[model samples]
Target: MGDCVIEPEQDYKGRVGDDPPPYIKMPQNIWPKDAPFLREGLYNYYSHVFPLAMKLVRIFALAFGLEEAALDGIFKFPITGMRALHYPPMPKEECGTIGLGAHTDFSWLTMVLQDSVPALEILNKHGQWVQAAPKPNSFVCNVGQYLERQTNGRFVATVHRVRNQTGERRYSLPFFLTPDPDANIHALDSFIAAGERPQYEPFNVGDLYIRRVLPARHRHPTSVKYRDVPESEWKYELLYG
Candidate 1:
């Protein structure tokens, strides 16, 4: 367990293509060397929260009439971490784009604990943005692409966003649960036997993380080349496709 403070104002500046911004402050080796506060918070999260989440997943798996172990391996003793984020108050003019940009998480599951600031929104199927009502003591649970693949689309990876409406600073803790980098996320035969075929080609989790998530952080100054793939092939593709 490791901990670090995320100062969004000081860490992240303008948009991704804007002038080079200052280095964002993040924790080093957050797993074993996490700060005391972070470790404590995460310990409570893992102990109290994860079991309930596991129960929910198990119920869903049983609903599909699959063995509990089918989904168990995907989440068992995973290398998960929690992120503590601080969003500062922005002027009303800049509030539109002040919070997190519309994006999906890159993990199996995410449990978000938000303060009473009330700026989070979820994108509905009709392309409308709807406000997410914050509930007390209940973390916002959302699925990710990895889980969607593991469950053969039985579970959905939803898109969510956050905005800071109040004048005060907002704090949020998002727990990201993931399997090992080399974990295989293909749908099981039992899951696929339910009249739906696998939607995606078999790909390694490490490759997805490197290609998608890692690049968003600490990008290289020059483009790095892969041995067999050409630069033209780097165009973005939806993960579910």
Candidate 2:
């Protein structure tokens, strides 16, 4: 492996944004960098990643007791987002502090390609942090909030955080597969028993993105409209950072 390089953010001036951009982002590839056109690699990964994600969704659908093609409509016009991230080495002084905060992804699913420099961790049922180190070229996949809502919480979405204690720079690529903008997400009728009740109110794909997700400090601009429905009434809804 090549020795990792750590560059001071000041050298890049406005190029790196005010707060190092919360980890290197592939935000529609709009962010600037030394190699601005370095998007070919991302596209290369997406070519394979998207199809794999779709295939996995069908498999999950069957496992969750729904027909294999149950998710076909949602996948027909899905918005699959991909990102390539780079987290520079943290100083020894702030090693314990958070590099990336904890939050649950609202997408249907997320797959990560992590490098040797470790940082990712997930919050387990016991509320303890668990390290998720990389292994060769294998990708780490996580269940997301949408999948949980659709399953009536059958498969809970994981809450994960990142910290870069390694003296070397850390890199990872995460691809998120989300439903079509206008499609609605709800627990399937087939999963409910005669006396069982549905845990959540049906919501459109846009509600989770616009209302809950967009209010973050480093905003992700989107055209999706927000719903006034308070997250409290929806027991299944989870807030975002």
Candidate 3:
């Protein structure tokens, strides 16, 4: 996994100024141009991890009597990508917010592999944060916006955060899986028919991607308004508001 750190020629320091830190792309054909790490990661995820995730998703779908493929079309091309993250040791004074801020992923699914460290936490419905401990050879999975939309309020996209509380350096690999750029994301009819009404309005995955790629302050105004709301809240508001 360390071999994946293909640094880009230009440092990302000056590019974004002081928002979220800059991300450095791999230097070599670490992700071959033709393959575009996005595609490569998707391939690897589908081959190695999708079965497990899909099994869980399928069970949830069956509870609603929805076909397995009800969610398949949404994952076509599955914009999956790997993020190699390194959190430096924190100073005693700034120990409170050492890792990442509280936020949820923007994709359909996220599979994380932690290396001998525990830094992730999930926010429950009551808004309390709970630490997510590392399990041996097991990956941490979280639902994302696309799936939350497709499930029509059946499944959820939960809130999560990361913090290096032990005053130690940390490294992690998060594999993000998303819908194809051109795919349309909306509540599935079967889900709606079996469950409650669709919670979110129909939206194109490409449009969401564009908004996500831009700076948070620069994202579409409507999207910014509900950035901190739970997926359930945003799903309804985005659909009707």
- Considering only N, C-alpha and C atoms within 3 Å, which residue pairs clash in candidate 1? 1-31, 1-34, 2-33, 2-34, 2-35, 3-34, 3-35
Number of the top-ranking candidate, with lDDT as the measure: 2
lDDT of 1 by residue, 149-201 (tens): 77777777878888666656788878776664546667756667666668776
10: Cα error in model 3, Å: 25
Residues 38-117, candidate 2, lDDT per residue (tens digit)?
64555566667767887898998798777998888766545567666778777788776677899888688999889987
- Which ranges of candidate 2 are over 4 A from the true structure? 1-37, 217-241
After superposition, which runs of candidate 3 have C-alpha atoms over 4 Å from their true positions?
A: 1-47, 50-64, 193-197, 216-241
Clashes of each: 7, 0, 3
All candidates' lDDT scores? 0.61, 0.67, 0.62
Tell me, what's the RMSD of every candidate? Answer: 10.9, 11.2, 11.4
Where in model 1 is the C-alpha error above 4 Å? 1-46, 189-196, 219-241
Name the candidate that leads on TM-score: 2
Query: Which 10-residue window of candidate 1 scores lowest in summed lDDT?
Result: 3-12
